[model samples]
Target: MPVAEPPAQPPTTRTTPISPSTPASPVRAAVVGTGGIVTGSHLPALRELHGRVRLVAAVDTDPARLTAFRDLAGDDVHGYGDLDEMLAAERPDLVLLGTPPALHAVQATAALRAGAWVLCEKPLCLSLAEYDAIAAAEGTEEGGTGGPYASVVFQHRYGSGAVHARELLRSGELGRPLVAHCQTTWYRDRAYYSVPWRGRWATEGGGPTMGHGIHQMDLLLHLLGDWTEVRAMAGRLVHDVESEDVSTALVQFADGTMATVVNSVLSPDEVSRIRIDCADATVELTHLYGHSNDDWAYTPAVHARDDERRTAHWRTPAADVPSSHAAQLDGFLDAMEKGVRPPGSGTEARRTLEFLAALYKSAFTGRPVGAGEIGPDDPYYHAMHGNHPDWAPKEQ
Candidate 1:
């Protein structure tokens, strides 16, 4: 591939920053949903930024979970069963949503309308229509500026390895990326789908393509810039579920790069990987859930292998920062403090979501899907599944 160097920063819609007169006190934050994600990721990340973020409240429909959250978050943190009640009481500066996929749009919109910035988990919402509604709630509909914005948690795009790779690719140090592959294959037993919302189209969206592989796809789009089209196939396979258990897509990027992507919940030996073959070198990352600098490797092409200066540049090491909620949160807080939309907010987030929607549309329609093809009039705009395939179970 012989592509030009793109802009250094990711594409984003310009929005007015918060007023400089705002108080310098720690940002008051509340956690929505006391699920495993909250206890395992968001809570610890919040605690890591103690001086900058004060955990003020938590919400969960289940009383026991709420109580557990209160116990772990300390007495100062109040617990509530209702999100709206907690929002009204705490009036937090930030809201971290760890709820199920179906509730994300409603909860995030509520938080945004309440003048709170939101950090939501991946697969931000079920459809582009819901995404636009959340964007409108961010005050962009009136004047693209001011209070409240929503960002998705795409931790894989953080960390030293990904950052370095992005810089190298952007600067043409890795020479234009020609071919690539992204794999997100993990095993999930039948018990996993017993969680009610786990495999449903109305709730969890579109199987591994929407939920599991989205992280890697987002990272791929982050490094490659923009994708132009996608051709895909999906199936339920071993699992008796409303959505497919496995999916594969052939993606085309604007820079003439062609990439193969695979998302699965049936692989015996699980692994998440991304490999980019460029004119000068091949860069790869291999890890399960998260990765550190050690998980990355770079190899120069045969013709360029003898170039000492180029090889040395690729070998230089950076601080070993693992991809985690804390890493992404730190950057989000920086953007918040500066009064700008974070990396994974606004258009940047929608880009990833739209791609997934297109993948599903392609699979179900038995045709290729293009970027900017799905609009308000398109059925897929309202739901990931659109007109359900014959194989899809009917809604109850």
Candidate 2:
């Protein structure tokens, strides 16, 4: 696919922040795709912030699904069979995309060009090139601090536990992070792959690495900062699928932290987990799908256990906010209200996407892949598979 030309630069003037004394109008919002994610996650999130955002439109190719969504969204919401039509008619200020992974780049580019902000689902695009193109569409060259930016829905980063942990790590309160482990082990039987897009490279991107484990991996990166290199291995052990059902990687962070990452869909006993061992404390979060304050624990090192003040600081609780679509949406809405680029957008999101590409490259090539190595000229920059390895399952 040809890259989209960057849209005309808009005014760089910042909008005044929304204040309680001078209330601002609700943001006009539209949602694309009426799949399970739309109904189960995005819709409920929008409803939670009804006073701040109005669901002006919804789009879906499936007529039955569209009608069902419209019924649930009420008569005030407009429904469209096509995304372009909905964008032209509603001209929403925000576009929430719950579409398939293959469609994110095109849809997000379209919404950005239409002068709307976008909050898209995971595996934001197919490759690094696609991510760069979307960044360009967000007016990055003209300074990306203003309107019409795109943010990905890495909801795990917005939870209170994550927020607090990040602060401690950033402030050196937890000391230097030494060793870490991130896991996204969830079971998916053959029946789950029956969905045409579930296991295909062209459609679903990669296997559990891109689709399932990305959430926890993203959170790991969020707390650990940039990664320098990845040495990985992957295999299609159980299910008959084009992509690997299990992948394991040893990642090196720029901060001198070495970590292990595992993404799998073959584990019968399922869980999502991340553990970071710092000089002074060990921080661990274990949960499935989402996490909360209760799921996080902080343990002081043996030497520091005697220091009551230090231990208390590490254990202090922040407000209990679980990792959820709603929490992330609130952050996005805050950014929109302030007329600034939101978290999980542009380069920040690209980091996670790039890390995934590196993992795949390392797995397929049987070598370490480094940061900033895959550029426009690299095959992996255009597609995750790059030079397809013989070990990868042949597409049937």
The superposed Cα distance between candidate 2 and the true structure at residue 390, in angstroms, equals 5.4
| Model 1 misplacement above 4 A | 1-24, 140-145, 389-396
C-alpha root-mean-square deviation, candidate 2: 4.9
**Candidate 1 TM-score over all chains jointly:** 0.92
Query: Which candidate has the highest TM-score of all?
Result: 2
**Tens digit of per-residue lDDT, candidate 1, span 119-148:** 999878999999999998885433434547
Clashes of 1: 0
Error of 1 at 31 (Å): 0.3
RMSD of each: 8.9, 4.9
Candidate 2 per-residue C-alpha lDDT over 35-105 given as tens digits, one digit per residue, 9 for 90 to 100: 89999999999999888888988888888888888888877788788777777767678899998899999
Q: Candidate 2, after superposition: displacement of residue 322 in Å?
A: 0.8
